[model samples]
Target chain A: MSTNAAKNLFIYGSLLCFVVLVILTIDTMGKLDKRAPEITEEVNAGKKVWHKYDCIGCHTIFGNGSYFAPDMTKATERKPKEYLKKFLLDPRVIKADSAMPKLGLNEQEADDLIAFLDWTSKVDTNDWPPKPILASAIAGKAASAGQALFQKHDCSACHQIQGIGGAAGPDLTQVGARRPDIDWHIRHLKDPSSVVRDSAMPAFTDMNDEELKALAEFLITLK
Target chain B: MKYQSHQIALNFYTTSVLLFLVQVLVGIIAALQFIWPDFFILNFNTIRTLHINSLVVWLLMGMMGATYYVVTEESETELWSVPLGHLQFWATVIAVGAVVVGYIVMGLNPQANTEVFGTRLLNEGREYIEAPRWADILIVISVLLFLLNSFMTVMKTRKFTAVQGVLLGGLTFLALMYLPGMFYTKSMVKDQFWWWWVVHLWVEGSWELIAAALLAFMLHKLLGTDVKVLAKWMYIEVGLVLFTGILGLGHHYYWIGTPEYWLWVGGIFSSLEPIPLLLMVWDAFRTTRETRVPVQNRIGLYLTVAHAIFNFVGAGLWGVIHTLPQVNKWTHGTQITTAHGHLAFYGAYVLLIVAMIYVTVPSIRGDKEFNQSRGFQSFWWMTISMVFIVITITGAGMVQTYMERLLGLDYVTVKATYNLWFWIFRAIFGAGFLVGVLMLAADIFSIGKRPAS
Candidate 1:
């Protein structure tokens, strides 16, 4: 191309792209309220708390930030709110092996952070932090309701089943054969220390009787 | 070196190399923290913040220095204000020094709101450009001073070579792009949205223009190539880079609460991001072969060539692997992104600045022919080690994706168990790179020394 032609292409082309970007940005901004509508006062305060602590320094949200820790984009969806709160306050209490240094947040800060995370979880991220495809494949069949509960509670973060979970908790691949009793599993779920002395597992105090039964029944099939 | 004011570039280059050394050292510490979490006095996050912030500052400083030298030579005029250049350099140095110290002190306490001089201490907690609001302001002032000095110098000559115009334009855009990242947004969505305007746009958008300008200037200086052809290629390169990169910002937007339309837009545009880089690489090689003069600064030539090849691979190819939503769905926020980042930054910007220093510094020191042994050795050592590091880190990232993202295992578990070897290899190769950096420093400092005569 001639020099003038190239120069014009350079100038006009960039301008065209910039205009398209601005228009798209406007359209995106218009749609953001509907897509991420949960931006409340608590969520805004929680965002400041996020920046104040430099949480993004380690944990990523929306795939931005250092990747030293887990992405928080789906944190609210991954763990229960109460569990996340306690973990934020003191990570070692929940996972003894967590590398996260406690940020020493007050209850209000913890609450706000969780609110921000909950809001992030609800944003339309084009299905990012994608569902673990192999998780279902490794389960060897369609996910059962109880199996879904196992994942819903993020139990795999602590417990292992079929060699696809964490090592912090015991391997549950043969827990059905070992325990062999649904009622025992139910009792243990409700109060871990009650069943086993000094169990590191936190009690499923938040799980209802149906959830507890469903989870315990799933464990019975793990053998 | 021909102009009286060209000497100011020496200070900038010296400070930049020192910051480069700081980046590598802090980078090693950050790498160590990956395996031994308690290895450092500071947390990994703080160490990482320093490592990245230092990289950005050093490269910007180097670019400023290079621009000063290039502008004066191209315009056939002395710098407009040498004292102002010195002032800008010192201001930058102070701001960077204060920011680094603030990060360390805050790392000790881990408090975001620790006030110093009536403002918050340390970073704004965002990655990359983590400078506190005050430091950010100081940086803007320093950059403005630099722009004014360059602008005045160019205006004195009343001549606009492609090199001068493009270089100044790139510097101006570099300053402008940073404004979006300065303010805090109440919404995380908005904050991240604007943050890319600085991070993504600077690297992919504005910095590409700077790189093209520098490449053209260096090739012309080294090879006596025709400026008309160089300018034409640069124009083509800049046109395509902006055409693709501006919209390619959509790739970052896809998973940041932006509309789903970005999945299509980001993927398509970013996939095309490599085309211009590839063209530039081809053009560089062809130009090297068609040179009107034999190259004297062989080390500079080597670095410049490496810059184009690595830019294509590290920034273009690696970026495309996950730019598509189909692939990015799993790799987003993983170590795969980390692999891409380290390589892309080193390949695209770091090598360019290092090349400029190699080419210009010897001239500044009045050396007709300097010792090339250390320069050649450092070039090989740094490049080979960096390639190996990128390979190992990509291995780690792939494993993390498979085990953690695919198999639903925990991230920490994958890192501790499966990816430990990768991080170990990364550190080992990082040490090799440190050796290269030291050698380069030694070579640059001793450029004027007679070699065992």
Candidate 2:
């Protein structure tokens, strides 16, 4: 083909492609615009906190940031509010080995962050970072009681059971496989320093016997 | 050099080479940090940001230099304003240096890090376009100065070659794309959507045009091929590039809170992004085979051909592997992406710039015996090392995806499982790549002393 003809073909083809891109971009933007949640003051403040600290430098949100830490897109659904608050204020309080430094956020800042995480949890991520097997394992009345105890004791603040929770502690998804003895877990939970010397884990002496048994049973089902 | 004004390009080239060395050193630090997180006092983010920002800066410097060199020669005239060109070059150097220093300081003072600074300074945490607002402004001004100098030179001669037109067009688009990265948005989705305009468009769209123009100019000079024929091929390549690449931006949007339609749009268009590159490879080989005169600078031809071939493999082939939405679900942000990034950047931009430097340095230095055997060794070492790096990283990424994403293993387990690949990557491929870069530096700098030939 002649050079001018090729040039014309290219110019026209590119123009056509640009038209298509514009249409698709408009359509996608419109959809996203509709999906954008109302920017409440709390959510905005939370987003500010997120950026001020550059959370993206360490954690992935919707699969965009560094992979050194877990994805926080579903943080609200993954961990309870109190646990998230404590972890945010002092990551080591829950997970002794957490790489997340204490951001020294005030109580209000921590609450704002939770609101932001809550908003993020509602985002349609197309079922990404799939749910943990422990979710299904912890079912029924006994599991419910154990879950309440787990939240009250802020267990998820340290131990990640699935794709959720902090990374400082060991993932409890397979805790049952390692320590199957219920009696051993009960004793260990009451006083972690007794079983493992130099254990950074805080003991759960405040829990009653019934609550301890339920939590132990719940952990056993993690396998 | 053909024109006295061509000396301006030498300044840019020297700066580019120095920055290239810094980029490689920072890259080594980044790779080591993956194994030993606390190895350097500089955080991983800072080192990585420096590595990428330096790469972009040096490559731009190289392209600017190549543009001046090619335009002057093609027009058969001196630059429009040698002083203006020098001014732009210096301004660019200072601006880039300040940005690098800012990143280091911010890394040290993470608490004081803020995204908002009323546009006077905005040190964003975004990848690639991490330059603050002031740096962005300086860059835009520098690019404007360059475009003015180049366009003025071409217009004065009244000699608008197809090659010059394509390159100038590409450079113009490159400057325009940088605008999107300067703006701040509240939504991460919107922020990323525009970031690809700067990133993907440059690599896949405009930069390819620049590369093709340089390739054609080099071939025309070396092989004495028909400029008309080369121009025709360039037009075709530019057509394919814009047609596929503009829409190919969708590939990045699939997981960044964009609509689902990107799944199909990104897959189909991005898969076709390699056609122009493949065509360039074919054209290069055919022209060489038809050359009646023996090639004098074998290293130049080797790097040019390697640029085309490796661009196809790195950007074209590997890019398509995970470009599809289905596959991307598994490999997005994984080592697979890193593999593609390493190869694609080296293949498309790095090697092309080196090819331009290799072919042009002889003329710039007035050296006849420039193509030493060590040049060829550098070529093989860099190419082979890059191939191994891509292979190892791809393997690591695939395993991580399978174990973590598919099998529901946690990030820590998958990371531990792939420790061996990281070691291999640092010890072998990383070292080899660094050595190759240093050898190329030695080859380029040692051009004047050619045994008094």
Candidate 3:
């Protein structure tokens, strides 16, 4: 092609692309405006709080921050509203080992932040930050016995069950599905260092066979 | 070396290399943080902000320096104001330095105490363009001064090559695109939308023009190729890039609260983004084949060729891989994105800038060549390390996608599963990349030992 012709094509093509982008952007703006939750003054204030604190520095909203923390796109749905409020006020209070430092937000600021999160949770993310499915079947009496044992042992201190506990250890909400081998669980709990060499979990050597079996059974039902 | 004002470029290049080293060091810290979260008391966010901002600043400095060298040489005149160029360079360096220091200081302080100061002194926490408002203003001023210096030189000479014109035009657009990033929008969607305008447009849009012009100028000089033919190819490449890249902004809009039509627009347009890159590769090879002159500066040729080929794979192929909405849904905001980012930046911008440095610095300093073995070793070390880095990260991303997105595993669980890949990425690839950078630095700085060609 002639140089002039190529230059002309470049200009024309660029114009065309620009026109299409403008149209698409306008269309997207309309759709997003419609899909977006009505931003009340409170929500707007909450958004300011989110930015003022630079929540995005750690937590991702709509999949856009450092991956050190959880994706808060669906934080509202993932946990109880009260749980979120309390956690926001003091993360360490909820989970003593949470990596999230207390941002020292006031009551209003905390509430506004929650409101902002609530608004973001309503955005159409194409069903992202997928919800974890809990096991539906109820555990038999042994599993109940395990739950009692879990509470008695204060397992929530180091491990998260469902979304409420320390983040120091892995969440055991899906431990049953992840590790189907009950034998591995029993061995891990008893010695804590047998399966994983660098495991920080303290051994529950004091628990008798019955308690260990019950705890393993209860964990197996977490799927 | 040829022009008296070319010394200005040396200052920029020196600072560019220094900043590049700092960027890599911070990048290593950021990468290591992913494997061992408690490795340092410093926040990963702060390290990451430093890494990305330094990359952008250093690359821009390199581009500015390269443009000055090329325009001065092509116009056959001294710079309009060498002192102004120095002023702009120092302004940029100080602004960038201040921002980095602010991040470190704020990161150490309590968030509550620094919240207000953060808006002015500390960063805004936006990715890529995270500079505070004051720093952003300083950058805009520096860019204007830079544009004025180049524009005045071109105007005074009244001798404009097609290569120079394309580069100047690209730089002009680069400054204009950056304006959108300064505006604060309340809507997250709109904020993100404009953010890509700066990020995507700069990388895939204007920067490609700059890269092509540099490549064409270098090729014409090195191979004695017809400037007419090289200019025509450059024109075509620029056209193709702008046509696709403008709409290619859609690819980032997906799932960011934008409408669904972006899926179609972004997917279709961005898939074509690589066409211009592929043409660049073909142009480089074909021009070399058609050259009557034997290639002198083999390392320069090697870097140019490597830039073209790697750009095709990194920016073109990997970019298209996830451009599709179906694919992006799974890969968005994952290590897959990181994999593409590392390769694309390294392949296109980083390599192109380095290639320019290699070709221009020798002539500027009156050196014939650096040690060829050192050049080749650094080239392979960097190249091989980059390839493995991309591969390892891509593997980790795909696994995370399957386990977390597909199987609904927890994010932390999926991340923990990829500890091995992260380790490889840090210990081997990261170290190799740093070593390669040091070797390149040594090769470039080793002066007066070799005889002039």
Poorest stretch of ten by lDDT in candidate 2 chain B: B114-123
- Two-chain DockQ for each candidate model: 0.66, 0.38, 0.28
In candidate 1, what are the lDDT values of residues A1-223, reduced to their tens digit? 8988998999899999999998998898788878886678999878877877888878899988988887888777746576677778887766666777776788999999999999998988877777787776755343677887887777876678776776656779999999999999999988887887646566778889898888888999988
Clashing pairs in 3: A135-A223, B1-B364
Candidates in descending DockQ order: 1, 2, 3
Q: What lDDT tens digits, residue by residue, belong to model 3 across residues A1-223?
A: 9988987887778878778777876777667777778878788777777766566666667777655566777666545465567677877666664556676677898888788788888887666554323211221223378897887776654467664454546788899999988888899989876896545566788999988998998899898
Q: Could you tally the backbone clashes for each prediction?
A: 0, 0, 2
Error in Å for residue B380 of model 3: 1.4
Q: Which stretches of candidate 3 lie over 4 Å from their true place?
A: A89-108, A129-223, B110-120, B447-449
CAPRI class of candidate 2? acceptable
Clashing pairs in 1: none
What is the DockQ (computed on Cα atoms) for candidate 3?
Answer: 0.28
lDDT (0 to 1) per candidate: 0.86, 0.78, 0.79
Residue A196 in model 1: shift from native, Å?
Answer: 7.6
State the lDDT of candidate 1 residue by residue for B370-443, as single tens digits: 77778889988898999999999899999998988888887777888889999899999999999999987887
Candidate 3, residue B312: how far the Cα is off, in Å? 0.9
Q: How good is chain A of candidate 3, measured by TM-score?
A: 0.61
